[model samples]
Target chain A: MNIKAVVGRNVRRYRELKGISQEELAFDADLHRTYVSGVERGVRNPTVLIVGKLANALGVAPCKLLEYKETS
Target chain B: MNIKAVVGRNVRRYRELKGISQEELAFDADLHRTYVSGVERGVRNPTVLIVGKLANALGVAPCKLLEYKETS
Candidate 1:
């Protein structure tokens, strides 16, 4: 899968696992709600810096955003 | 440390470990040599998509790019 899809999927998964809303995540990441939504949809590509910010907002390591676990 | 610094440091470290030049990695990642150089120098921020490409070029997982091992 493409990196965008990987990131978006993980972001959504983690966000849901944390029980946080997109608006809250966006606020934590200092981004727009629309931007977060777009990212979740794989429509926008975020830079490394942005990834870090998102990681911080999500209370995870930046690498966590990039991890893709295959389902059995 | 900032995300840019983390990514740049890791990219350079991985690139060196693989004995690959920035130019070569750029080619593999479909990026410009200058862009790779900038990324290594922590002067540029790459998107999640770019991170994926770079990880692929380096033969590593995208999460590896985000990992920061704290030195004791």
Candidate 2:
């Protein structure tokens, strides 16, 4: 799987686990809602600093956002 | 600690463990040597894709480069 996809999937999974909306996450992460939307959709290639912000808002390790089981 | 610093430290640690120099790693990762140096010094805010490349070059999970023990 693509690395961005892995990150997006993990972010969505964690956000759902927290029962928060993307808008809520964006607000907490101090980013635009559309930016957060793009990130969750794997369309945004965010810098590590942006990843750190999202991870902070999600209350998870930044590395956790990058984890995925390979299907190969 | 800064997220970039954590990644840099991990990159350096893994690179050293593999007994490779920055030039070797940069070549493997298809990045410039000076860019790799900047990354190791925590002076670069690389995207996740760049991290992926570095992780691939270092033969480790991308998440590993972002892991660090909290010291606060």
Candidate 3:
């Protein structure tokens, strides 16, 4: 799989695991809701800082988002 | 202490450990050497794809870049 796909998959997986909506996650991460949706769909290429924010909001290590590389 | 610094430090650390020059790593990752240097200096907020490419070139998981969060 592509890097974007891996990230999107993992983001979706983790986000769902946390039982939070995209909008809620966005609010927590201080990002736009559309941006979050774009990331989830593999259409956005977020910066490291953005990833860090999302991870902080999700209460996981930032590396968790990149963990998809191992499975795919 | 910031996300960019953490990534830059880890990238430089791993690159040094691998005994490769930034030019060589950039070539391996198919990115510009200056871009790699910028990333190493915490001046570049690279996208996930760039991080993945760099990690691939460094022969480590992309999460290695993010592992800095735990140590810092």
| Descending-TM-score candidate ranking | 2, 1, 3
Candidate 3 lDDT tens digits, B13-70: 9999899999999999999999999999999999999999999999998888878655
TM-score of each: 0.93, 0.95, 0.92
Expressed as tens digits, the lDDT of each residue in B1-72 for candidate 2 is: 889988888899899999999999999999999999999999999999999999999999999988877652
TM-score of 3: 0.92
* lDDT winner between candidates 1 and 3: 3
On lDDT, the leading prediction is: 2
DockQ of the candidate models in sequence? 0.90, 0.90, 0.88
lDDT of 1 by residue, B1-72 (tens): 777877889899999999999989999999999999988888888888888889889999988887888981
Could you list the CA RMSD of all candidates, in the order they appear? Answer: 1.5, 1.9, 1.7
Model 3, total clashes: 0
- Cand 3, B chain, TM: 0.92
Model 3: docking quality category: high
Clashing pairs in 1: A46-B47, A47-B46, A47-B47, A48-B46
After superposing candidate 1 on the true structure, give the runs of residues whose Cα lies further than 4 Å from its correct spot: none
